[model samples]
Target: MDTHLKMIDFDFEKLRPIGLTQVVVNSLGAMQDTTPPGSRLMRIVETQRDWFTLHDGDAEHRARIAQRLVNVLQMQDSTVTVGDWAVVTEGGADDLWIAALLAPVTQIARRANDGRRQSLASNVDTALLTMGLDDDFNPRRVERYIAMVRAGDVAPVVVLTKSDIARDAQERIAMLRERLPASVPIVAVNGMSEHARTELMPWLHQGQTLVLLGSSGAGKSTLTNTLTGAFTQDTGGVRRGDGRGMHTTTARSMHLCPQGACIIDTPGLRTWRPDADGAALAAAFDDIETLARQCQFRDCRHQGEPGCAVQQHIAPDRLMNFRKLMRDAERSEQTPLERIAIRKKWKSLHKAGAVRARDKRR
Candidate 1:
């Protein structure tokens, strides 16, 4: 391996169009300074099983991770996902190799059902969490999405799609506003129309990068198409029975908006568990955390505890959801042995209750 990079004429301007900012550039201090010889800086637009689609500000190129880079990522327990910036080399004719991955300023991730941390997108400035105003709408689910995005330090904007058809659109919006933090903006739009871009323009500034997140039938793909002013993503209709939208977008892909911003459209997440620890979860639900501090007991769980400030002020459903999320976070952080112990403890408690019931009947 060469410790020194062979210098070549390169223009920094090429990186800006693909979301290269001073923050990202500064993070690449020595990484960019020591770029591999014959390599070019590029942004990952599409990620697949073994290859990636990289944009060199002017065009998209298919590239594969170099064996050395793969080994390093494996050791670090990470992967190169969409929205990542990398230094790639022209390996050969029809071959592009990702030699090094620059760190992302922000990364949106979630915990899979199998307990693996799945990286959704990296270097995103905002998360446009799209949810339908129809049967697919669930304020609890909205809170979960907010937690997942905010956990990664990205701002979340709640986009309620299918607003034109939803008769109670205003009522739903008011309900959500009452439950959510005042800082989070909630916008209702008809995803099929061009007006969606105008309503969402505040977050789509030049050089900004945004990720559309929500479950299937949430109009993420439709919104992506509207924002980009092209049919870049496939949109599907929701089922008449459950109002669940068919999964039209299968993978994460970034599209360049005419406004000079980038939009990453992702598959609707059927299950989204926050990939965060207790502290991170608490930070996401600062309202609950703030009230918990005023509890009489230092370690109150907010479950009917005496002098529980959280229960006194927070809505019951919101409080319950927070408790459930906290429990999930704690369980995820537990070691295998610890989790087993918790199960055994609950099993014993259930067994004891059953024994008492049988004795009383006898």
Candidate 2:
């Protein structure tokens, strides 16, 4: 078998795709502990419908998702995503089937409208939270993305692209540095420069996997091109009025960087609702969470409570955003019926309030 893998560089971590060596060990038909000594662990670089593109750092091949792989798990959005490792048996295009998915060390995903997970990538060591300094800049959206990264347990690094043309780009960077945790790393860069690659070198170590996460037209692909030293992905411009970019990269695909790291670039997302809990929210809002602990009551909701520490310490807008995320998280946990009921309840309350106000005028 011509197992085509090129040892690019030892500097980058090939920690993913468990069997990059392609030493075929057959695993049983199921996701069992023991291998049958003929299956290879292949990392999924890109998934197209029922088919997947597997890369073991050396060779790239295609395989189909086996019908009997698992009883229907609710991945209605898509079965497989970029950066998933799969147990497989070597065969020609039509003969191969992905036996099972290798559990990812970390997964960055978003909640679909139908209550399913839309995976951006799996086993990503660092999530590059890219945002444009131009029209695309929004602190509110960045806060949501921070929460999303926290939900996935991946290290979040802020990358402010297009510094050359952005208005007061340095000021924006300074503001973000203050807004986010002192521990979280932030860098402003020209997406087309070698500076962008150098700025992110710490996270691009050997065997490390990085994922590009930002809205469409946020310069994710351009950054990928700069890092990889090629035009591997397409690029697009943002709208002039709103500063929103066109969705240039329509699919989530993994690439091997010339710098010896694996990177996944995803499409622009207009709506990103994280499937998060209290801990995730707290982690994202670290400064505010710390202040919350100082409140007089253990169950301080931070709403005008006599000695509400979070309200007193944090800015009103930041606190409001945190509270909004809390409400969203709670709402997400509700079943469809419960959500409908809550909506109706709110409508009824608003109607009653309107009636009372009209009577008060009388």
Which candidate has the top score in lDDT? 1
lDDT of each: 0.86, 0.76
In the range 1-362, model 1's lDDT, one tens digit per residue, is 12223432234577676788878666655665566556777899999899899997788899999999999988876888999988888776769899888888899987778777789999999999999999998999989888878889999999999999997889998999999998899999999898998999898888899999999989999899899999898888989888888989999999999988999999989887777887887776889888888999999978778999999999999888887888888888888899899999999999999999999999
Q: After superposition, which runs of candidate 2 have C-alpha atoms over 4 Å from their true positions?
A: 1-37, 75-78, 90-94, 354-362
Clash totals in order: 1, 15
Instruction: Compose the digit string of candidate 2's lDDT tens values, residues 1-362.
Output: 33212211111134333223212222222354443345666788887876788875567888887676644434433457788777776556456677777556678877787777677788777889999999888887888888878788888888999999999888988887777778778888999999888988887765678888888888999999999889999998988887778888878998877666888999888887767776676688888878878999999888899999888777787778887888878877788899899899999999999999999999
Overall local distance difference test of candidate 2? 0.76
Score residue 28 of candidate 1 by CA lDDT.
56
- Residue 51 local lDDT, model 1: 85
Give the runs in model 1 whose Cα sits over 4 Å from its true position. 1-10, 32-35, 352-360
Model 2 lDDT, residue 45, Cα: 87
